[model samples]
Target: MRPVLIAGGGLAGHACALRLIEAGFEVELFELRPFFGGRACSYRLPGYGGSEIDNGQHVLLACCTALLDFYRRLGVEHWIRFHDSYYFLEPGGRLSELRPRKWAGPAALMAGFLALPIFDFRDKWAIVRGLAAVRRQAGDHRLDALSMEQWLERHAQPPRAVERFWRLILLSAANEELDRLSAYHGVRLIWLAFYGAPGAYRLGIPQVPLGSFFAEALWNRYGRLRRHVGQPVDKVLINGGRFHGFEVDRRVVEGSAGVLAVPYHRLAGLVPQLEADFSEWSCSPITNVHLWFDRPVTELPFAALLGRTIQWFFAERGGSYLKVVISASRQWRTWNREQIIQHTLEELKEYLPAVGSTTVAQAHVVKELCATFSPMPNLEARRPGPVTAIPGLFLGGDWTATGWVATMEGAVRSGYQAAEAVIRWLRADRGG
Candidate 1:
């Protein structure tokens, strides 16, 4: 049997390759960039002593089972540090901690929400009602037709609760405003992270750079697997309504089966024959501002900022360095680097008083204009599955129908699904 060809070395592609190799199939992976991780990657900044930093602050919740399984497969589970408590900072340095009470079991999240001082009794009451609605409306297809904002309004969520609570959490997770996000995705996120399982809401931060997750040395044990970095797949060759091969660097690389794991935006140019309609598809942006200070600013490892342009900040290098993330940052797309840096610093000082005294030694900004697809109402119906009309061809990406928003976990799930499809196809072909 020929090697299974996988295109685009992102999480989806790598996950598919690993799964195929484990299933006793030879696999070949091709990537455009020299590195493996696509959006979730780290690079050495040119200035300020070549410090390595992720393009953005990417964290995972314990509800991300597929991503955790991937980490365990690579023997790097220990590199992730999970925090049970979430620190939310208001203006004037008012701090509120949301930590689950283990003794409370399934009701721990509810207890923590009720104890928070940031929201008044009215706000909390509205939120409690909203959560109850979410639990009751599980698996409701009508939610796919409504936006999260509309759902929240229907549930009578007050302005304060919407702004400080729902907007803050959903925007960061979905990378889109509530008005543009599908209520289906929003409700599923809340249910999985907070209400589904015990200890599922804990936040996990990577101790090492994201690129280290797919280091070349890690694939040494997979003898049948081959990697082709810095090579782009120009076209997908099809004959007799079946995937034949891929054209790369003016040469054809044939495989018994193939997986196209690239982003939706790049799908058209590679294989226009599929002719999937993506006219309604749009993107959302995320901006990250990295600031290095002469002195430490805050003791907390990370905090969610309330009533500010900067939504969250992750402390690095003993708190002297910080990465501030602004999700759904369409407004900031026009602002220059200087403007973003200045605004972030100003907001930081309001939450962390020490930021006012500290001098910023260096600052860098990263803007991902197409960070993720906007999870609009009815978009889930448009997301394609692994199987395609073409035989021996499969699709894998976070944008596919993974029943989750675009995240690392969704990406991995798509890959596994594609691999399973490929395995079934091969077995059926061999009369197994």
Candidate 2:
């Protein structure tokens, strides 16, 4: 069998190649970048003690089964450390924790939420009622039409409660403001991970850099799989609207099938028959601020900052190194690097007061302008599916209609879904 050519080396493409090989198809994967992992990958900064840093922190939830399975397949499951507790710090340096109680079900979560000093009796009861409403309406189809903010407003959530609690959780998960996010996703997140399963809300942080999972040697473990980095597929060759192969580096590369696993923004140009229109699709930004101090600042592994532009921070190397993250960070697009660092330092002082006394050793800022497609209201229905007008060409990416937002789990699921489509098409083509 001729190898199935795959375009894009991101999670979707990588996952498709692996699944195709397992389905008895020879696979050839092309990545324009010199390495794998795409937006989830890590890169190093020259000088600055020769330290390697992730492009951005990509954490997973316990409920992300597909992503966990992908990591297990690569023998990197142990690299993830899952924690059940979430620490939130107030602007005045007060701390709050969210975790399961001794009992199970909503009662367990309610206990934790009630214990938080930030929320009053009214806020707590409003939230409990709000979550009960979410559980009841999670399966409703019309929720997709409304923004999360609208849903919360209709549910009578308090202004302070929405801003401090609901907005923080949903914003990080959907990578968009509550006002712009779909209520379906917001409710699904709360119900699936919190209401449905007790342990599903556990946060999983990779113990190592994300690039380690994309090592060339890992792909070699699959004998039928081949990888080509720095190789860009210029176009998917088609004759009379029939799928053929891909054109790479000005040369035709023959294949039995092809999977277009690139970003949503890059799909239409490479495979015109797909007729993918991303006019409604827009990009989201995530900014990371890394600060290294001469001495330790905080021992906490990670924490969410309240009432600040820096949403979350992760500590490493005895807390000397800290990575601050801001999702949906369009506000920082215009700020220069110096301004970003200065503002971040000011914000850090509130949570980690020691940062004021410690001398800064180094600092770096990375802003991913197109990190993920924003999950705005009405955007879910606009996403394309795996199959296309071209029989042997399949679409696979986080942007696809995988019933998931633009996430690693969604990307992996789309790859698997596209690979299934290709296998079924080829079998029918051969009259199998």
In candidate 2, the residue pairs with backbone N, CA or C atoms under 3 Å apart (3 or more residues apart, or in different chains) clash, namely none
Q: What would the TM-score be for candidate 1 when compared with the true structure? A: 0.99
- What is candidate 2's lDDT per residue for 133-192, written digit by digit as tens? 977898776898999989998999998789777988887887889988999888887776
**Candidate 2 TM-score over all chains jointly:** 0.98
lDDT of 1 by residue, 10-59 (tens): 89998898899999999999999977889998888886798988888899
What's the TM-score of each model vs. the native? 0.99, 0.98
Candidate 2 residue runs with Cα over 4 Å from true position: none
C-alpha root-mean-square deviation, candidate 1: 0.9
The global Cα lDDT (0 to 1) of model 1 is 0.91
Question: What's the lDDT for residue 178 in model 1?
Answer: 95
